[model samples]
Target: MEILGDRKFVEVPGTATHELPPLLVRMSPRVRSLERVLGMANDLIEQEDMIPLPAMPVEHDSERRRMDLAVNLVDQYLAFVQHWQWGHSILEWIRQCETTFDTRLELRNLLRADLWPHAGRSSFVVLLEDKLIPTAGVEIEKAVGMRLTFRQPPPLKCFSDQFLFYLNSSVAHTAYQTWAHMIPSPVSSLPPERFQFQVVNMSLD
Candidate 1:
């Protein structure tokens, strides 16, 4: 209150007042899903297409609707992924890590994820690379009904040393494995599964 005295304190309803509870959005670390968002961020930069969001008028109703949908998708992307175990197709799950001691901390690294308040545990973490934040933040702010920007410790800074992996016959199995290594699968109907890793025992200390 004492630092910078500029004008009298009168709250403006448009930007200052809170009228309703904020809507929460949640998302999981699904790389296939967020690729569009990354592309949208690129679009905010040098647009190869002459017609961008603003120039499109209401007459182009279909395009305008698509644009609105994209903004909402980004909002959902901003939300944290709520987890539920025991659901069908629930291959993996870790619980209550933000507040409790994580048994799987040895396997999953919280700081490795890219989202803010990176204090929780997840079986998998997905993050946009640090360099993309500035340009993407600008695009998010441009959303007609949304306002968003990046902050300190940008997303994916948490997921410092990680990489996407895949399974191929070329990746042979060894007696021992480390890092983001692929392991053999026993199922007769399924091929080998690739796994992300966090190695904590390399130090001789």
Candidate 2:
């Protein structure tokens, strides 16, 4: 057992380590550990500056495993940061990734609600104009003020599940319709007399 800012923990090698993301630490009771572990965690973060991407040579199986562990640890850490803190210090990390080809960005489960995910990619506002369109908030009561409740959820992958996706689909359809109307209609091959110039009446059978 060890003391970490008043709490004690069992120093098991693999157990407490796997859940940790190398980039950002998770804020929870699980983070209990000795001062040394915390120092090592801080060192892991500091080491990123000096060490390059693909941190070690991966010629042998052992070396490859080491490289994989390093990369995966950083990847897991970045994901944890995004999940826990949306408007986090993700911009600095993104810029670093863009600086080199070896650095890769693997992000999943992106949402429109978050304030500008690509803010890191381009520092200028011109490139970010696309995401400027505001979306309607699904608020139950505006009079009482905004409050998010997550106790009950709707059906999985249902039509109502992705409200923003449906909104984008609608916008796409409208744009397609507008473009379609702009195109000229095709001319008939046969003579004008062969086809009736007037509209024909048809049965609803």
Estimate, for each residue in 1-205, the C-alpha lDDT of model 2 and write its tens digit.
2344632222222222111111221222122233433344344534543234466655676545545544544333323222222112222233333343123222221111132221222221111122231212211111011101111221111212123223423433453344323423221111111112111112122
Go through the candidates in order and give the clash count of each: 7, 0
Q: Which stretches of candidate 2 lie over 4 Å from their true place?
A: 1-59, 87-205
Q: State how far residue 12 of model 1 sits from its true place (Å).
A: 65
lDDT of 1: 0.25
Best candidate, TM-score-wise? 1
Candidate 1 least-lDDT 10 residues: 185-194
If scored against the real structure, what TM-score would every candidate get? 0.19, 0.17
Kindly provide the TM-score of model 1 when superposed on the true structure, using C-alpha atoms: 0.19
On residues 87-205, what C-alpha lDDT tens digit does candidate 1 reach at each position?
10111222222222234333233323342222221112111111122221222112210111112212321211111012111111111122112322110110002221221211122
